[model samples]
Target: MRNLDLTTLRSFVAVAEQGGVTRAAAALNLTQSAVSMQLKRLEELLGQDLLDRSNRRIALTNSGELLLTYARRLVELNDEAVGRLTDDVYEGELILGAPYDVIYPVVPQVLKRFNALCPRVKVQLRSSTSLKLLESLRRGEVDLILTTEEAPGQGGETLTEMPLRWVGAQGGLSWKRKPLKLAFCNVCIFRAGVLRKLDDAGIEWEMAVDSDDDRSVEALISADLAVGALLEDSVPPQLEAIQSCGALPDLGIQKINMYGADSRKEVLGELADMLRQGFAASRGPVAVPKALTA
Candidate 1:
């Protein structure tokens, strides 16, 4: 009986998802020729043309569509089987630190999935500003940390760049008021961008709340006390992204990054992959960022 290569299926899936071979190659950390070769080999094995390349963009043939469905299932099942079979029975405590903003919504999902994969590993979470989290990592108080870079290309393994936007209370006119009232942490990455832009735009601003607790900042915004800046996706339901409020500077994008004392730890590696996967699922199939690939 002929056998199918899981590696070929993976390459096909990457090509399909990325919408082109070049991007798929970059995403897979494979050369263009290598990806093309994988696809060619897979097509040859099945005795069918999987992709229709008549136009500038490639589309899937009828057979390719059918194969994609099975490919995805096969890949998922194979991954599950491998994980179940090869996973080390690990028992240890992992200390994870991240900004309060990341703790909500995002990190929780990562933790839930990680717990399922490594039930014996206990994760102790610490929430603070990115600056504080970095300090904790440096001081050997935390095993791993997720943080936003203060400047472009500054620190940690960058996962992805997230847009920073101004957020204010729902149905509130706080953004319209001059001398903007802001609520953010003292060491927040967005704070400097917010301040710099506001200054450049000739808009006056004051810190209505300066706490590292994201809940406190949310509370301030919910009460219409001040506008805050946060990653566009991380903005809570109580707050609405305020982009058109006049003279507000574009806060730009910040890199979401991970830092750890030891990336080689079994538990930490798995947890990091889970975190990256969670974030990637939200943003579409993302290549594990280069820094963490090692």
Candidate 2:
């Protein structure tokens, strides 16, 4: 049986994502001709035309689109296997700051993958509000940080974007109250934006709880005392995303951005790449915390 080459597959995936062979070559650190040759070889081997070259910009053909899905997964799986098995070791410590809202379901995966790649590189994770994290980054107190913002800040690389959500008790009626009561961390990044959105909608709001502790806010929200805003996937177990269905104004989208790290360092660059992959990975469904129902 004929086999597809992983190297060529990676090039094809890059070209598809980067939008051209030259761009892919630069990204892969391979010559343009070399990337072109790999793409041709892959196409010949498959006996299918994968790219539509008739247009000014190359685009994926139906077959290429079909192949891209599998290619990404295969490439990711291969890289993961190598990272886990390789004995490559690097020693260093990097301080990483991120907001509490986005620490789960992505950061854990990134840390695990980074550990496999650089077992000796100590990464100290500090969780705070986004505004505070950005401040720490500016002060050089943290080597790198991730921020949640409506728009990415200067020198920031956005990893992913999700819609901001109004979250509250699963079966609560607080949303029905006028001058909607809100529970937010003292330095929560969403506070300003959410308030603006509410104001633009001509809705009045009152702060029901203001504490630096996330659990304190969550606890109050869980009791139907107040509501809060968060990114869609960041909503906690105790609080469910409010299906406002027009009852509440939309809080808009939030971007998860990386800032304050120079990619010149190999390990730091790898960590950023890992975060990119981690955020892109499939997150099937959010599970209900059993404790919530118990």
Candidate 3:
């Protein structure tokens, strides 16, 4: 029998987990035909059908089920080996992911310091919504993720909890309007908390702008289109805190977290500690910087 290739095994596993070629292809960023071809090659090498296509719904045959168990174990071991070997490279790459709103302002300085401390380590940074970052982490695409504690999805260790507050354009509208206009990211935890509090208080509110990027939200607020809730540290200087809005009902604070594969426990732990200390130092009560709290 020809030896099964890792690529083929990975494709097969993706299909099995996703339950369809189209979905697996999308998940793996491969064409459907390519995924099918890999599966065929894998079956040919193993000399047994891995999926029962006789039925409308795909099901693993007895032999296929057994092979899947071994395939998954092999893939996991392969990944672990790769991680270990790469760690030994000294010039190893660290893939880091985070939401832009939380990291954009501070990441450059953090990266510079990290590089100076571990000059041999190469870092690649990606910015996206917390949900997307967590998805990438689960798929083993990213080695580390830093996200708000209120992130909807699971997985990750809490590193720090940052305060969130309500803010708006200086001299903007009053809060008595029913359904206050609010600017926020559609999936933001801080936004969700704000909404929940409004609902509980029976205060109607409308989404002035549902955006994923902080820059867009900032623009809306700057234009005085609507008020916004943001991390205490993230509010830009042109805005003023609407303390009269009632403490944002204590959005319970948002925590920052770090996540990675199980094998990365040691390194992730170290990074998390460094991040916690940095955040604490940066958060001293300095009358919110003028740039952030005009």
Candidate 4:
């Protein structure tokens, strides 16, 4: 009979999520050599190599990918169990606001880690456009918010910056349409800037989809009925970035900003830390978990 160790699994998951042993070690507050050894031990136990060391950056082998899916769940459950049993529990709801497109590649993972630490905290996620979310934050409707905009305005801090890309359904031809058919939700922060860029570049366009609902815009884009703007990493699996290739004008890099970071600082400490880690992870392609984009 054999058993898996939670400590080693934690190290493995950190390494996967952090994109390297060094970053993973920093995240876990463990020495680099210690994280490396745990990864080595896990590989020995599983009888398979988990990390591909061929490149400068670490990448998961197929076996590594398979193991990661289970590891995250196991570690999350373990933490939740411990936190629920040992910690002074906080029981309340947290109203969170975030733009729909920026939800991926960060928010979901942050929710998991936050939930584990504060098992009783019901994280109420409010998805809306950045400006609306900021308004919600100011109105005290949301506890904290994540926004994607050209830059953070007053009372907001930038988490990470990512280039906005022209996104469309796989092999979509909407970009080629004369008077380009654009699809974006009514209040999207990117919409106005995108339109300006198109006009400045002399690309004539019309709103093919202009519903206030995100799904309507996404549906039209995904069906190849129109094209839209999305963050570089948050683009859905069914979509691919349309190559500008001197055809479409480029949008500026957008910043993911956090609002109301100081409010309830003590209560949201764990969640804020997790969000920082999650956003930092988005900088590297290797750190992105499937759950993020999915």
lDDT of each: 0.75, 0.79, 0.68, 0.81
Cα error of candidate 3 at position 72, Å? 50
Task: Count residue pairs with overlapping backbones in model 1.
Answer: 0
Best by lDDT: 4
Candidate 1: 10-residue stretch with minimal lDDT? 285-294
Candidate 2 clashes between residue pairs 3 or more apart in a chain or in different chains: none
Q: Write the per-residue lDDT of candidate 1 for residues 71-117, one digit (tens) a residue.
A: 97887677666556655665689999887666655688678657656
> Highest TM-score, which number?
4
| Candidate structures ordered by lDDT, highest first | 4, 2, 1, 3
lDDT of predicted model 2: 0.79
TM-score per candidate, chains pooled: 0.68, 0.68, 0.59, 0.80
Task: Pick the winner on TM-score between candidates 2 and 3.
Answer: 2
Residue 251 of candidate 3: its Cα lDDT? 59
RMSD value for candidate 3 = 18.0
* True lDDT of residue 32, candidate 1: 81
Ranking by TM-score: 4, 2, 1, 3
lDDT of 4 by residue, 1-294 (tens): 668899999988887776677667656767889988998999999899888777655678889999999998999889888879855657677888888778875788778777777887789999888889888888789888899888889988888898999999999898888879989888888889999998899889999974789888888999998899998877888889999697988787999998777876566766766777677655644545322211
lDDT tens per residue, model 2, 155-218: 9988778889999998899999987999988788888888888898999999997578988988
- Kindly indicate the candidate among 2 and 4 with the higher lDDT: 4
Error of 4 at 74 (Å): 7.0
Each model's total of backbone clashes: 0, 0, 6, 0
Off by over 4 Å in 1: 15-27, 47-66, 89-93, 100-128, 152-155, 169-173, 185-187, 209-213, 219-225, 232-241, 244-246, 261-294
